[model samples]
Target: MPDGQSTRTAMFRVKNLWIIHLLGWVLFMSLPLTIVSREPSAGFPVRILQSGWFSSFFLVYATLFYGNLLVLVPKLYLKQHYVAYAAVFVGLLVAIYFSKPFERLIFRNFRQEQGRELRPEPPREGFREGRPPRPPHGGDARPMPRPNGERAVDFVSLTLFIVVWAVAMAIRISREWRQSERRAILSEAEKAHAELSFFKAQINPHFLFNTLNNIYALAVSSSAHTAPSILKLSQMMRYITEEATENYVPLEDELACLENYVELQKLRLNAKTSLDYEVKGQPEGIRIAPLILMTFVENAFKYGVSNHRESVIRIAVEVAGGDIRFLCQNRIIERNREEERTGVGILNTQKRLDLLYSGFYDFDIHNDGEIFTVKLKLPGR
Candidate 1:
């Protein structure tokens, strides 16, 4: 994908996440409005909104949710500060519990201001017998009992706090996992790209060295085909420097490059060295990894040619139904010390194949001390 498109996609995903969070919080906060108990009357929603207890509880839960999501989970829990994180969590829980009394006081005062009692007062004892209520003497006044539903309300509120904390932690952990996976995928892609470039660097110079040696031999012998060989070399180098830099090139272009290489090699061969190169494919719309087929062809020419002894090299390519089949066969021959040290191109090409194609392609090599054979099958682009 293009950089601009990728950036736009990332931004779109971020916006979607924000929208999801906003909707989630809205739905969560609206649950209380649905479950609130109140007499049917005008402005019921407004009265509930004006209640100090409702507003206080809403604000407290919202603060706890965001604080845990943004600060506590990432900064403490994810950083492995387990003891500190637990301490902070317990502190917040205690603080919330202690604030309940303040919430009740504010609600009670709000009800008094609205000309209503927080709850109906119990009947006075001995009042039905026409006896005057005894005045509290000194510090002997009895304390009122706690409300019946207060404990249940506190239990429910504390449960909500725990639920919110768990939700925030789960969300943060899941997001972190997704981000780590993305980073790993990107790192792997970059490593493969770097390795492929290194392999190409190795293959390019090695190819030039061998091709130059062939051209040099022809020129030293004052052969008539030397100039034509140089022209083929120029075309091949143009393809390498220009089109081959891309990961994949048009199949026709690769075939043209291979033909140039074969013709260049032919300029240095004798009658005793037999060569056959054939292509049975219409390589128009297909594409292939650049220079992938060259290493095997170069190997054939290097080890299959001789001026004093009979040798054979066969190369073929067949393309059919979104698949390509390539074959190279050459007779094995003894090599000098310098030639024995020169299989870097083949090794690098093998590595490149593994990096680029992996399971998508099949490659086979066989050598029986007389004939060396290579067969490769690749899916088309």
Candidate 2:
């Protein structure tokens, strides 16, 4: 889905959930009072008007409900301000107690109104001798007797309040935990990307230093192939500087880069050295991390080439069945003692593969007596 549309859908669902909670609370408070009362079968609306707990209980409960959800839990409880949270909680309870008289007054009036409407009195008679006067008819009947205000401070309300508070806290904490996890994941991804970029940036200087040395040797020897080699190097450098910085590049571009390096090396190697290169399958639309294959090819030229004996360098790239395979091998005519030091390019490639492909790629290196080989397989991008 488009991001905007998905976000809007999510918001709509949240709104519906809020509406459901509100309706559910209303029914929860009103249903029992309607069912258990002895009054005649009044419609739901009339019953709600006469209901004892619905009016002020709902008011007080709702006040605390949202207060805890929006304020108390987030600002105090979640912050581990337990003492302050408890103080505020106790204050709300005490306020509920002090609010009892008003709730009773409202309940008494409602009941009286319902009573008068439902049950009218017969004509009143004069008081009997030695008896107090009878209470007046409907207009002035004594209000329903006030029940004990202390009854308001019972276990049921307290338990229900606790349940609501628990729910609010649970919801708030879960949301915070999820948000924290998302932030952590995002942070990790950004850090990995920055590291990969650093690795890529280091490759150009490292590879360029080696290539420049080869160019200097060719320039010193005054080889006729020197100009073309320099041209190829320039093109390769342009590609690296311009396109290699991207997260991915066309697979063909990397293959071209490898070809340039191979041709440059050919100009500097002895005629006895034989080099074989092959590419199979289309590279169209396929993208790969840049400079990933260059290190092994550079290693082949650096330590695998010798003028004293017949040397062979083999490089192949294949793309088929939604996978890419790269292989490079060279006969070890004479190893350069200086090549014992592993270059930074190889280490950078390892780190880049881990950051970008993780377990999705295969990298293998084998060195036996006569030959050194490298093979890499990657899933299609």
Candidate 3:
């Protein structure tokens, strides 16, 4: 993806996150309006809103929610400061409890602003006028029961505070986990790219070294094919320097490069050597990793060609549906020390296949005394 497009996508997600949070808070703070009273004359819902208690409660909890999410969890809880985190958490809880009186004060002031004086509720029906009712046994007067609504409100406040804290912790922890996962994925990708580049670096020089040696042999012997070999070498070099720098190239371009390589190798072949190469299926829009198949083809010519014995090299490529299959078979011949020393290309190519294709591709090689064969299947785009 382009950097600008990725940046825009990230920004869009952040904006959506903020919007969702805003909507959630709005619904949460509006809960007081949903409270209905059996006694309509009590005006429970309107009184709750007008008293300013719910507003103050919402404000404090909102601050705590964000503070815990953005600061406490990240700076203390996630860092393993358990003792300090517990202490700070208890302190916030105590602060919330103490803030109840402040909330009542705001409610009182709000009522005063509306030109209404706050008043205590009248005693229950069992109580005499301005006098407490006696207990049935008359040992000691039983304490009057508190109103259910008042008890429910206190319980709900504490419950909501704990709920908000848990939610904040859950969100922060989840966000941290996602971030770490993203970092790990990016790190793996970068390492694979660097390793692949190192492999390509190895393959390029090894390929050039062998190709230049072939051209030099022809030039020294004054073979008429020397000039054409040099021209093919130039074309191959251009493809390497320009197109092959990308991770993938058109399948046709890769095949054309292979054809040029085969022609160049032909300049050194004798009557005892025979080469058969074939390509099937339309490769017009197919794309493959650049130079991925070159090392195997080069190995065929390197180890399978001999002036003194009959040698045969067979190569075939087929593209069907979304799959690409390649086969290379060559007759093994005795190799000199120099030829044996140049086995790095095949190893490097195998590593590249593992890095780029991994489980998505299949590769196999077989060597039986006189014959060597390689088969590879890869997914194409």
Candidate 4:
């Protein structure tokens, strides 16, 4: 396998084992030195050269064991810090017990067998050849295993093992922390999606309520076009309820909705008030979020039509290929706080735009003391 693939596979497989791995590595790294470092003064580092891939057996098993302990320790006994520490301490002893017996066997047996293979050659510095080695008693002529400083190695191995365990546990703990953060971000997104759906649902009832009220007024006034009003309303209602739920709706359908809404509003208003609606750039089939433009439309009608004064609502939409621009401007009446406060509905609409468009939208809201203006330009990617 390639290096990256091998590392990834090892990471997945070893993320769960613990103590058994610690014992295995301690034995693997130490065994070669004990066995093959026979003639320690022979000027050859046989422990390393001869260790070979057999050492990897030790590496894989030992790392896995240490990793397992890290996960299991914190998961099962986190609140009981003292007990977890105790279990670790006991596990250490058992690991050494199973692993220590190998040191003596590795050194003593491999060398003894190897020495016998090339016997009677007076093996040199290791056993003190010929007359045997000293015993502080002067009564033997047999070759014996040389002193390879086993006690010193015992201290070194134990110290190194403790250090390895500490480092391995830290890695596992850090990985756990990152996984938790990913889960938290996903949960927040789900909540925002639900909130957007709820806000989107509110627009339907508000639009219906206002439109029905206008139709009722026309009926009472006995206008000649009441039938046309009801028919326009049916079309608008069907268009909104059936199509707006989709991700995007044709710009023409949305404009038709706005036109129907304007016609409905005109029935209540006298002919002197002004409204300008324009579509520049042949923006017929361009798509947009359902009802994204409706809030601005409703706001314009609510505040722009003066009962007996000159008032204007100007709305213009321009679409060209992948770009769309919508501009809504209304006269700002200083004394009408209720109509101005209804402007807060724009906040919910702005939030939806942020979620859906992100980098693709430019929205500007400004009031130059007389005119309240909103400009939004969105580009498709």
Taken over the whole model, the C-alpha lDDT of each candidate is 0.83, 0.78, 0.82, 0.71
**lDDT (Cα, tens digit) per residue for candidate 1, span 34-108:** 544344246655676687666776777878889999999999999999999999999988876766633353334
Model 4 residue runs over 4 Å out of place are 1-147, 154-175, 282-286, 334-344
Error of 3 at 380 (Å): 2.3
Question: Candidate 1, which ten residues in sequence have the lowest lDDT sum?
Answer: 101-110
Candidate 4's displacement at residue 301, Å, is 1.2
lDDT of 4 at 376: 92
**Looking at candidate 4, what is the lDDT of residue 90?**
66
Superposed Cα deviation of residue 193, candidate 3 (Å): 2.3
Q: In model 1, which residue pairs have backbone atoms overlapping below 3 Å?
A: none
Off by over 4 Å in 1: 1-11, 30-46, 97-147, 307-309
Model 2 poorest 10 in a row by lDDT: 101-110
Model 3: runs farther than 4 Å from truth?
1-11, 30-47, 94-154, 336-338
Q: Write the per-residue lDDT of candidate 3 for residues 1-381, one digit (tens) a residue.
A: 999999999999999999989997877655434432233335545666665566676677889899999999999999999899899989987766755533353334434433443366688668887787767776767666633213213444566678789989999999999999999999999999999888878888888888999999999999899999889999999999899987888999999999999988888899999999999999988999988899999999988999899999999999999789999999999987876876576788888888888889999999999899999999996
How many residue pairs clash in each candidate at the backbone level?
0, 0, 0, 8
lDDT (C-alpha) at residue 303 in model 4: 72
TM-scores, each model vs. reference: 0.83, 0.77, 0.81, 0.69
Q: Clashing residue pairs, candidate 2? A: none
Compared with the true structure, model 1 gives a TM-score of 0.83
